[model samples]
Target chain A: MTTQEPTNAENWAKPVDSLHIAHDLPDHAINLNVEGKRVASMTSGFGKMWQKTYRVRLDGARVAPQQVVKVWKEHFPEFWQKGQHFFGPMASISPGDVALINVKTGGVKLSTGILVLYADDVSFSFMTPEGHMFTGMITFSARELEDGVTQAEIVALVRAQDPIYELGMMTMGSGAEDRQWLHVLRSLAAHFGVEGKPTLEKICVDRKRQWKRFGNVRRSAAIRTVFYSVTRPLRRKEKTRASA
Target chain B: MDFSADVRQIDGLAVIDLHGEIMAGADDALTSGFVRATTGNTGPVLLNFADVSYINSTGIALIVGLLAEARASDRRILVSGLTDHYKDIFEITRISDFVTMCDDEESAAAAAKA
Candidate 1:
């Protein structure tokens, strides 16, 4: 690596002042907790850190890694499980793009977003903004195995962003996350006309929690989204009265 | 080129010389290198990336995993020889917060001794 000629220079997103969603989203896409938020890396979260990987071999598909990645990037949201909405930009997934997500988990609808941290022919990654359920980077990629099978994989290095999320992670949130990625891989494999059984590996990278980050609860998107929903009727009445 | 890691002791610091592109395939080399570097040494471990060609997002996650391990063991970490681009990356990923970034091997060794 040299100062004048950095390798893979075009593959990374330029450093940003803060995250900003530039794309127009659907009418129902609750666009909160993303704009003006700084990306929350694994270090910034409050809970124990974990590295979870989900993988599935596309058996008999015979697709190259780059081809799989290209298809995945082009149809990114279609592979996600139902009820989890990802609104990517009109263009393909690229470095610096901000994507909105509306997901219903345990009967609560939460809206959050991710910054496209890096992208290349074989892989792309998303980093969560502050107030997301987890602070982390999720990378999706494909690689060729020894037997010439292309394996699609998702690796997430994450930690719960607040105490409430930490509690959820300890209960049902972690398992739900696992299932979500598994569904994605299965969908991707099915797209190539193959039946794929995904495998998972979880590693507890750090057991200690950062107690100092307890204040992050104030920025929780779940709490904010719930409040927004609860006060919608009042907001509608206020609008009607003002118009009259 | 394939990824490789070499560990050397400099002024009691374990300096890991890293070469080649760092991606998902480099996991074994990186982990084994860290283990060898910190096995008996109580001082800081320095990762010298002077010869590294490229690092993807997966590579960055591997470094974060290493940082987590170092913190868990109460050990210090030092990084040296990253290009300007990766220096920015280290900042963006917040890895610079936990590890001391040095410009070259000599200063890193001096700091390790100090």
Candidate 2:
């Protein structure tokens, strides 16, 4: 890790102000924001998909892409166990350029994808199982907010699409997918040490409310079916009894 | 392919100790050992992993299958002596929530008795 500040040119090429969009045919688009500013956005056309976004501020300095990859591999070896290889060559990373890896492989049926972002003051990534590909972005910037602590905001916008989302709809309700997204966010926060703060707590609570709303809908449907079964026969019996 | 087992009649617990790497081709032996421990035994079983070196996904599936069988038969199954690396992997997959963890053979045996 280097403590040196990123040069002006490096920052300008991958500008802090502009948004970069990347998408392949039939894949999802990814959108990212840097320092609370939109930097990149991408969108994909896959039916029923999964998306995850994560951001974190590092205290020491920016770590190189290789080092970041090394750390990730160490922490998540099982991810590599399924034979998903790392994309691009390792030597292509320049001084300030962040490396992005889109993993596509493993587990059950659908093709899973993982996107990794490595930067000086922040690192984030998203992982999804098959049929669910994530499209999201991460931005890194620093500002002097308080005297000592720096204010770093990492926001993740994720959605479940495709089979899992559809399965959730069939089994758990529409909001079930949203609850899964909440778990993804919490897991990302835990990985980056961004959890336990008041803001994150509020975010989780909001997700919980969505889950409960969908749960209520499912419960009501179940109750309606039970009620219909119990009343239909009774009405017929009463009519017969009156005719008799 | 190293496997050992000791059946304690008083406690009605079977402790099976496995060693070496557990991968795809070697799962049958492991599965057989687990079956031997549980068959005709109406009590709990504890898998002692103190000597085990590594386990792949297939190995994990075998263990889960054994646990499922034990549960179906109203018998409890506990896993004892996991290394930190194994523990971390299990935690990531949420497998620890499904299986009981014990510190040693004695604790596993005692818990099985209860």
Task: Pick the lDDT winner.
Answer: 1
* Interface RMSD (Å), every candidate: 1.9, 17.2
What is the fraction of true interface contacts found in candidate 1?
Answer: 0.47
lDDT of 1 by residue, B24-87 (tens): 8899999999999998778899999999988999999999899888887888898999999998
What DockQ would you assign to candidate 1? 0.57
The candidate that wins on DockQ is: 1
What local lDDT does model 1 show for residue B22?
94
Off by over 4 Å in 1: B109-114
lDDT of 1 by residue, A154-212 (tens): 99999999999999889888888898899999999999999999999999999989888
Docking tier of model 2: it is incorrect
TM-score of chain A of each: 0.97, 0.30
Candidate 1 lands at a TM-score of: 0.95
Model 1, docking class: medium
| Interface RMSD, Å, model 2 | 17.2
